[model samples]
Target: MIRFERVSVRYEGTERPTLSGVDLTVPEGELVLLVGPSGVGKSTLLGTVSGLVPHFTGGLLSGRVTVGGRDTRTHKPRELADLVGTVGQDPLAHFVTDTVEDELAYGMESLGLAPDVMRRRVEETLDLLGLAELRDRPIATLSGGQRQRVAIGSVLTPHPKVLVLDEPTSALDPAAAEEVLAVLQRLVHDLGTTVLMAEHRLERVVQYADQVVLLPAPGAPPVMGPPAEVMRVSPVRPPVAELGLLAGWDPLPLSVRDARRGAGGLRERLADASPPEAASVPEPAAPPEASAMPGAPAPVVAARPRTGRFARLLGRGAVARAAPVADPVTRVDGLGVRRGRVEALRRVTLTVAPGETVALMGRNGAGKSTLLGALVGMIEPTAGSVRVGGLAPARTDPRAMVRRVGLVPQEPRDLLYADTVAAECAAADRDAGAAEGTCRALVSELLPGVGDDTHPRDLSEGQRLALALALVLTGRPPLLLLDEPTRGLDYAAKARLVGVLRGLAAEGHAIVLATHDVELAAELAHRVVILADGEVVADGPTGRVVVSSPAFAPQTAKILAPQEWLTVSQVRGALEAGA
Candidate 1:
């Protein structure tokens, strides 16, 4: 249904084209996944089909692009609205109305559909996306994941023949992501809708793709084929696919079930072997000796923190030891927070010790974000007490609060206001009283080689997130809180972040991350806390909590369960040791 013939696009002021000589075809009634590294024109390619390229984005387009035989060159986005429904990475920017129900219906109203038709479609979408309870909630009040579902439902209500989604499930919890993927499957199989989606979290969606389009690099021709064929040589791969490569399987298994069917031998080999040891918490460094100058009271110097295991192995020295593990960096007792008529958090009590990494997980609207907000002084508790670094967050001054805790919200854009990346980093360094290039250094470590002159708004979702995270880390707070921080990050980027966070943890920084990326939680978190309906339902070590819950388990854990393995690296390490 979508065809690109000799397509090449070059944005203004750029010497080379973003996409060069791309010839591709996506058949109707099929789901095609677009995969690539960050800023490799995945979004640009999707925009071409919806007639946003060259039309609204101010790019020069060459060659023909057609959707349902309608040349996008001739039809603007509004004209093709009935045929194409596009949902970008930022859902907040897509909404025209304030409430969930209104946002879902706005598209149909714009299409001038019959009121009855629009209403019926709205109800169907709400149920399909599990947004029924949130239908009446204001878009502003909804969580990031909830906003994503609403953005998707709003587009789905239009009943367009072609659907284009950018990181559709990035913000969703595992179960919620499955629901969205299932709905897309139904659309492709039962309704014959053409679905084109780009997601950094391939493990969540790779198994469902009917075909895969691999964009190797900028201006490079895209490779398209069956999922397995493309994944074999693709630079980016899912955990299961990586495992298949490691085990020398004839054909890589794209799903857990397939991997398990072929993993009996591998499982038996590992049955007696213990999983690799978790990253060790380093011992505290000794304090510096007092200054020896006569009459000068010894000037006390703080010791450095230790880095995480991965960082040490990689020789990055990203982490260091900061304080004794017994010291509590954050404490909450009988904490309760209410927003409007909703009790966002109820008597929630948790403690994060120095150098500990904790993950707060739950379905959409499950109070994770609200809890993070409270820790950062963004949300005041209605009852109970909360303290970070020996001070109440709500009562602490902004300057002091920043030193105690820093939060990277689900919407990274909220923390960014500068016109360019350079200015933003410079401002962050100044605000945090950090070294001149501290923020820029963090950004380079997180997202390397990005131009300083680039506007923050022009960056991909992942890039923006890295920038925001750098801004926060520049303050070097004792406690760090991240809300759905992995939304748009590819595996390589995630690995880099894992090292960075591990290093921070080693340095005696306590971290509480509210996330939906189970793989991330399995790899980085020491403990997992599950919340539902504003209450903590499950709290325990990462191994027990994630392995016991099928919805929260990582791919490797699912395949090698009964064995307590949570990552492909763990399995690989065991094999290498035995060999």
Candidate 2:
């Protein structure tokens, strides 16, 4: 139903084309996935199908693109709106209405559908996406994951023949992501709707795709095939696929179950090996160096605090947290928060010590981000106390708090304000009271390719995250908080972040990460804290906490059951040791 004939796109500023000779066809009633490294033009490629490329973005387009038998070059986005529905990376940018119900119906109303039809579709969507309970909530009030579902529901109500989604599940929790992917499955299987989506979290969505299109690198022609075939040559891959490659499986397994089914020999091979140890505090490093390539800047978007849905699924596995720490960097005791009538948090307590890493995990509205908000002084607790560096975070001075704690909120754009990457780095250095090149050095280490002149808005999801992290690290606060840190990062970018965080932990910094990325938790978090509906239901060591619940365990743990292995790196380490 979608065709690209020798298509290539180039934005005005860049030296290389965003897309080059991208010839491919997406069949009707099939779900096609776009996979690649960050800034490989996956988002730009999706824009062409909806005719938003040359028409709205002002990028030069050279190839013929057609959707539903209509030429996108001739038919502008507005003209093709009825035939195509798009949900970009940012959900807030997609909304045109205030409330969930209104947002869902807005698209249908634009198409001039009957009121009854719009209402019917709206109700169905709310139910399908588990948004029925939040129907009356304002778009401004929903979590990032919640807004993402609402955005998807809005486009879905229009019942377009094609759905072009960019990072559709990036903000969603595992359960919520599954629900969204299931909804897409139903749309493709039952309604004959076609879906073209690009997501960095392949572990969450790769198994569901009918076909995979890989953009190997920047400006490279895309490689297309069955999911497993493309994953073999693709640098971007899910943990299961990576595991399969390591095991020399004939066809790379796309799902955990597939790998698990063929793992008897592998399980025996790892029967006596132990998992790699988690990050430990390191000695202080020497002072910052002089020069390095510039890092990144990002768009402003704290307006949409990302929410996740896996909170409900979190209950599938639960354990109590570790013993309280003495002289903690931050502490929360029986904290409670209310957003209007919603009890966002209730009687929750968590503490992080110097040189420790803790992962705050739960589903959307599970109070993970809510707890982070309370710690960062963004949300005031109604019932309990929050102390950071011996000061009440909500009442502490902003300048004073900078030394106590720093937060890279779910929206990476929240901490960024400069026009260019270099400017952002310079500003970070000034605000943090650090050396001139402190922030830039860190940014370059985490993100190597971002140019100094690149605009924050022009950055890819991973690039923005790396930039935000660099900004926060510049402050050198005693405590650091990250909400969904890996939301937009690929495997390589994520590894770099892991290295950075591990180093920070080594440097006696306390880290609290609120995330839905199980693999990340497995790799970095020494402790896992699971919150469910505003309360801590599970807390313990990462290996113990994750293994207690089947749903929360990482891919390696699932495949190497009963052995308590949580990451492929652990298995790889063991194999290398034995070798």
Candidate 3:
């Protein structure tokens, strides 16, 4: 269905070609996974299949790309629309219509389909993608995962034989992302549609892929083969696969279900082995530096407040009055929020205490993001109330609330406006009263190699994400809210972010993160709040919540391993300790 012959594509003004001397082919109805690190041309290759490479992105292209036997270079995006359906990393970027129904019908209308055909296809796509309930909803009012489903439905309405998705689930929470993946599986199994996708969170999608295409970094050659074969030789791998290597499991496991079965026999052998002394085990290593380049401006130093204003406000100021109590820093009661006519939150109640890390999780349309927004006062709760530091979010002054609550939004670029890394950090310091040198050091620690002069916007997606986190941390808000902070980050970047969150939690910041990354929740969050269909279905410690949820239980390495392991180091430590 698709072919690239010695294809080398180089964007203008860049010295290196994003993809060079690439040879790839996909047969009809095959689900191919494109895997690689950031800036490794994974998206660039997907563009070729969709006729967005040389046609829309504008670049010097050598060699030929054929889709359905027609030269992609000769066909415009519109011309190839009948054969190719492409969804980008950002779902909102592809939204051209305001309502979900219109968005789905827009593509069919452009193709000049008959009204009856368009109507039927739209209905089919909505049902297929589980968007029937949201068919008439406004696209803008939908959540990130909802919008992404709409994007897929919009493209699929054309009834293209080949569907191309670029990091389709990167922005979704784990449950929501799974829903999207489930739809892809349905497409392959039920409709026999060809799927070509690129994603960073391999743990989520790698298990279900039929084939894996490993793209070489800027200076290396690309590799492709069956999923098992590709994973064996690939330098980067998911945790289960790595564990499979260590345990010498034949045909390494990709998903937790696979790993659990593979480990069943190994568990007996492991149990027979003598447990090593705990004191002999080394402590977990510090997280990797955040900046891409060394000597980058350090992150700002956050000043710890001498007194807890909330404690004082709640009449716990006197030493004699200080008693053992739950660290409730923020409280919510009967919280209700709405987006247009849809109720995002209805009679929601929760509390976040200082020195606790809570992860908010749910399906795509479950209102996790909306609840977080209400906590930070970004959106007003229509019927109930949110309290931040003993003051109502609606009544508290904006500046004071900002100082007490810092949020890292789902879209990192929303917060970044500076020309360089240093400027961004400097602006954060001025606003938060953070120490400049400390901010620089933190930036260097969190994201190494990002220099003071590096443009924030020009950095890769991972770098941009780290930059956003650094900016939020500079303010040293007592309450930190992170929304899908690890969406597009690679393994190394994710480790750094996880470590930072762990450190922040240890330092007494009440951190609430709304994310789809279950591993991250296990690693960093002390508690997990599971939302389903706009309601809290489960609320408990991380281990209980993770191990109990059917959706999250599949990725439960942290619970099985003995040591408090978050990163590879922790796992290695446990192994070395014979745990």
Total clashing residue pairs per candidate?
A: 10, 14, 28
Error of 2 at 413 (Å): 2.1
Task: Please write out the lDDT profile of model 1 over residues 1-579, one tens digit for every residue.
Answer: 999999999987666788999999999999999998887889999999999998999889999999998999999999999999999999988899989999999999998999999999999999999988888888998888888999999999999999999999999988889999999999999999999999989999999999999999889999999999999989889999998998888789999999999998898889889876566653343224212211112111111123576555543412111222334687676688988788888757666777889899988889998899888888888998888888888888987788789999888999999999999999999999998999999999998878788888778889899899999999998899998888788888899999999999999899999999999999999878888778666666788778889899999999887889999888899899892
Q: Sorted by TM-score, highest first, which candidate order results?
A: 2, 1, 3
Off by over 4 Å in 1: 281-325
Please give the CA lDDT of all the candidate structures.
0.86, 0.85, 0.75
Q: Estimate the TM-score for candidate 3.
A: 0.84
Model 2 Cα lDDT, one tens digit per residue, 1-579: 999999999998998998999999999999999999887898899999999898988879998999999999999998898999999988887788889998898888778999989889888898999999999999998888999999999999889999999999988888898899999999999999999999999998898999999999989999999999999889988889888888888767888889998888888988877776666533232223201101101111111112357545443322234555456787777688988888888767666778999898878889888888788887778998999988998888778888889999877888779999999999999988999999989988988888899988888877898899999999889899999999888899999999988888888899999998999999999888887777776666788888877768899888889888888778778877882
Clashing pairs in 1: 305-320, 305-321, 305-322, 306-320, 306-321, 307-319, 319-503, 320-506, 320-507, 322-507
lDDT of 3 by residue, 1-579 (tens): 889899998866566777889877887887899887666777778888888888887888889999899899999888999889999877887889899999999998998999999999999888877889898788877888788889988998998899999878876766667778888898888878999998878888899999999975763568888887888887667777777777788888887777777776555545544332111111132224312221122221111112566654533311110011243667676678877777787756566666778788878878888888888888888887788887776667888798889888887899989888888888888988877765677778777756698777546666687888888898889899988888777766788787887778777788899988877776677667777656555565565456655676534343244422333344445467665
Which candidate has the highest TM-score of all?
Answer: 2
lDDT of residue 240 for candidate 3: 74
Show model 3 residue runs off by greater than 4 Å: 12-15, 173-176, 189-192, 269-327, 339-341, 419-423, 435-460, 557-572
Residue 325 lDDT in candidate 2? 48
Highest-scoring model, lDDT? 1
Q: Which ten residues in a row have the lowest lDDT in candidate 1?
A: 293-302
- lDDT of candidate 2 vs native? 0.85
